[model samples]
Target: MCLNLKKGAIFVADSHFSEVNVEFLSFLEKLKKKEIETSQLFLMGDMFDFISGESRYFVKINQKLIDIINELSHNIEIIYLEGNHDYNLQKLFPKLKVYKRESQPIFAKYENKTIALAHGDIYTPKGYDIYCKIIRNSALLIFLNFIDFNYWLSKKIYNKLIKKSICSKMKDFDSFAKKRLSYYNSDIVVEGHFHQGKHYEEKNKLYVNIPSLCCNKKYTIFDGKFITTQL
Candidate 1:
């Protein structure tokens, strides 16, 4: 039976570009086939590896993304949570949906339950790191964006650091998940960034740390009445 999200569902952020295709494609196709697009698509952050106005490939790629949105816009709703990577996209794609952090704290209620969702970068114990913070700051991002060579170099370093962060220099997402859950007192805590796809019942509470759209598949399925699974 097809299950629609009665009170809406959320897809936590982070795109990481190429990582999106392989794993999540099958699941997205499944969601399409299931006629279950009632869930809202919330992109928490880093929707791109880098946004390059000068790169023809980057422009084409974003256009394809826009096409994907147009195709799914009706069946599903979309909201893009502003991330450090998406800063440049505003110039090229001004109309894309974006949210201000102070204005965030979007809600999704299901089966008389509610949860707050975000990229969860600020909440991470080591959250965003020193370099990440510097680059994400408005002034530096603007300066780097205006310079093609600088943007390219910055992209290379950013990818390299992100890889390192994902691999070695990190604490377990479960601990982070639990910590965030403590602040909620709600039914669930949905976060993305650690790229760790996990969710379950513990201590009478639900903690969900969504996996990245990069490489391995990750998505949370919420039927109108219940959460089908976290895949």
Candidate 2:
């Protein structure tokens, strides 16, 4: 679902928060304490390394962070764009505005310029789309939860994810941006996944690849133009 973009909006992407790296939790605390102020909080994607609404086991493991976000939602308008690592969050965050992968690239307006926001995996290969569909299906999640009686499956997946390196530099990113921008119809396209933390313009469209807070503690703030900074 698309919503209006308010000025002074904060955009955080790819935190990939896990038990070992809890900086994302600390950031949430800052927001809760009013240490950070914003009209809206945009969780671009991968906020959690792995979280599924169907599994209570995964939810319990990250309960503290969940609690903080739920509390913050009472006051702040949070728009969560579900990433590859996190999906099926309707039950996890009932109050917050959640958008799944299939319903992404939502439209908004920033200073009279049209904006398209997504988790940045939409334009991937066909195999990726099929994989996403299978993993994001509520029925599949329920089946997985049923088989993970002792949470062994969840533990194994989490362990593998924690060991994988999620930060890196991509080559020919400008060419990639040009291709991706063609799929969107907007003045500005904002997304998080590549962890590129850069901005580019193709034709009349602007593309903002938001940095991962877990990797560099960087985020984007919109004034007249999107500006990246470490918080």
Local distance difference test scores for all models? 0.54, 0.88
Q: Give the TM-score of candidate 2.
A: 0.96
Q: RMSDs, each prediction?
A: 5.6, 1.3
Task: Give lDDT: candidate 2, residue 123.
Answer: 79
Name the weakest run of 10 consecutive residues (lDDT summed) in model 1. 1-10
Summarize candidate 2's per-residue lDDT along 1-231 as a digit string, tens digits.
457888789999999999766778878988988988886999998999989898778799998888988888998999999999999897889889999998998888766788999999997799989999988888888888889979999999999999999888888889978877899988989999989998899677899999999987888888777889787
Q: After superposition, how far is residue 117 of candidate 1 from its true place, in Å?
A: 0.5
Look at candidate 1 and give me any clashing residue pairs: 13-44
Give the poorly placed runs of model 1, Cα more than 4 Å off: 1-13, 19-39, 52-61, 83-97, 124-134, 137-139, 149-174, 200-203, 224-231
On residues 27-63, what C-alpha lDDT tens digit does candidate 1 reach at each position? Answer: 4455567644555666666556654443444555456
Q: Per model, how many backbone clashes are there?
A: 1, 0
Segments in model 2 whose C-alpha atoms lie over 4 Å from true places:
none
- TM per candidate comes to 0.65, 0.96
